[model samples]
Target: MPDDTAKPERKRQARGEKRIEELLDAAAEVFAERGYKAAGTNEIARRAGASPGTLYQFFQNKEAIAEALMARYVVRLRAAHGEAFDPAVAELPLEEMLDRIIDPVVAFDRANPGFYALLADPALSPELASAKKPAQKLMFQRLDQILERRAPDLPAEQRTRTAEVAVHLFRGLLPLIMTATEAELPVLVAETKEVLFSYLSPRIDLEATPQHNRRTLTPEEAARKAAHIAMRSNVTTDDVLTAIHEARAEHVRAVENVLDRDHPREDRR
Candidate 1:
């Protein structure tokens, strides 16, 4: 016998999910316009075209709403990263690469003003702060990967530092770009690209050489790549780095053993 209530229950669940999306969309606009402290639940409900009781059913408070919005955006951001950080993107000249990568971030910011508003706010709650870290970390990791591709001979430590500095510079200027007047907006954005290019070109645009044998990644670069792969698992980067080093040590010993068999041993006179 078919359960008569199954279809109605699924329809109700779908409605609830749709209603939740509406609330989050309304909260995004209100948060951008009025800020978190100023954005009230009643105003959010009004903008969503729902009653206060409807919003209360889904969210306990404004903070919960903000956290939920942030969670949604973090997912969007990871999707953006997938496109922006494609390997082919890294193969482009740095100028075109900047456009490909930076445009998505800027577009995402404009589309969801509330996310940056949360980022710019100095008084953000710890919960909301933690919710945004995945987005931040993915950006950092991808930036480092791009540098690894463009400058395969660069030391891992230096490449990591450059990636860190570039992220900070872009983030520091982002709120300015987001809040700029119409005339100033394009100028500021162009200047921002100029600044990044100026900083990156010196590092990435070294003279080509056959010395590297077609410019493949060096040992350090390969290790960095391995560590990046390991990072996707549930482990700390430090542990991954340590494991990489130990593996390298074993590889070196194996190579030495092969050399000992292939070559005559040197004797002290």
Candidate 2:
């Protein structure tokens, strides 16, 4: 007979949910202070006021901690996106619609300071990116539904293309938003709305125009008026292209600044 002293493999302890929360919170701060690659489990355990043994009881390594944090972030992100892109928002005025969309996203970003750093980092574990897929799909689905409501006659292909462009355009703004100081953030948010509104206005019906003036301009007139406004600001196609290049350069610089301040690669010094 097998020795009675032999025991089954011990299941991981599940008693310290509060302590686990504290650990994850500490991990987020460490990851924010030092990029994930540079962040250490020891520091996280110290910050959480737990012994290494205690932390190991729950998590096998730094990667496990990160995966847990990423899971929490996904839950929050999905909830925020779900609220921001509600179908009823399609009936709201353009400015209100923009506020509804922008406010929750900004709030979410402010609440999860380390999330963008982790999400954008090419060095992040594959598990994190995989976890984000469902949230991404749900976000697009909500946007697609809104688009469908706004322009029921839009061709299926056109609607899909529009949704894709909108998603990519908004996502491109995340780095700038994440890196910006609070003083600079509101302006960036406003500019994001302006850029998104411009892109989306043409694709939807004339409803996005001011209510009193909605019926006044034909699509041709509306296009010309939008162009005229840009012309008044001395903006041209070349100017637009230049701005795009500058924004891309700015985004690259911002990401580098963030990563450098946090993780400072040895050779890059």
Candidate 3:
């Protein structure tokens, strides 16, 4: 007699993998269309042609599927990195080198907008968050290698810092560019590249004193300089000072808003 229980368990495992793939595909579509917060697990199961119970057998919930999807994304992104940094492309100029670094990321976001949407969610699962560290480290390693080869004169510390800064700057901006209007994205990309290059290679008089030696002004001295400038203009000193205060207040408000959006406040009993 066949071991009936063993056969059924094997079939269940096969079905479970197939069902997980289907669920991930459905979840990706839903996340792209409605975003992570608005997406529903039931809708994903429905699209996958699986019952809710079947879906649950493979994943604990929608968040688990999202985490899996992000893991798959990292795998695909690593492949893209290989493509971007292949030996054939390594001969390109520095500008093209920068493009190679950025293009893979932008292409991935464009190809899998839903997965990118899930990554943008503030409530991302811990597994997905942990996955990001390895991906970031790989990106940093790649950029650091390229910079070392291209700008051999750059100090080791500066190269490391630049790689760190570039990865973060691009990661934060890529999602915004992915979601921006077509007309707006090009402008943003150009301006971002300009700012990055300025930071990496500022024009300096090699013969003059290093920029680090410039006298640092105290807050009071800075304010007095501003006031003196305001006195020469049509604007009153009071008006200038008030404008400065308002700008500071607005900056504080913006930081608080970002914190509130990214983190939950504790409830008081």
Candidate 2 TM-score over all chains jointly: 0.70
lDDT of 2 at 66: 80
Candidate 3 residue 98 Cα shift, in angstroms, is 1.9
Decreasing lDDT order of the candidates: 1, 2, 3
Where in model 2 is the C-alpha error above 4 Å?
1-15, 206-269
Top lDDT model: 1
lDDT of 1 at 120: 59
List, residue by residue over 1-269, the lDDT tens digit for candidate 1: 99999999999999999999999999999999988878899999999999999999999988899889988988888888888888787788777888899888887887789887776565778887787777668888999998998889999987886676566546645655677667766766675565566556656667633222333333333333333333333333343233233333543344334333432234100
Q: Put down candidate 3 lDDT per residue, 75-143, tens digits, no spaces.
A: 887898887766444355434555666667667778888767766565666766675556546766877
Number of clashes in every candidate structure? Answer: 0, 0, 0
Residue-level lDDT for 250 in candidate 1? 44
Q: TM-scores across all candidates? A: 0.74, 0.70, 0.63
Ranking by TM-score: 1, 2, 3
Extract clashing residue pairs from model 1.
none
For candidate 3, what is the TM-score? 0.63
lDDT of 2 by residue, 71-142 (tens): 888888888988998888988776678789888987887778767556655666677667656655665677
Clashing pairs in 2: none
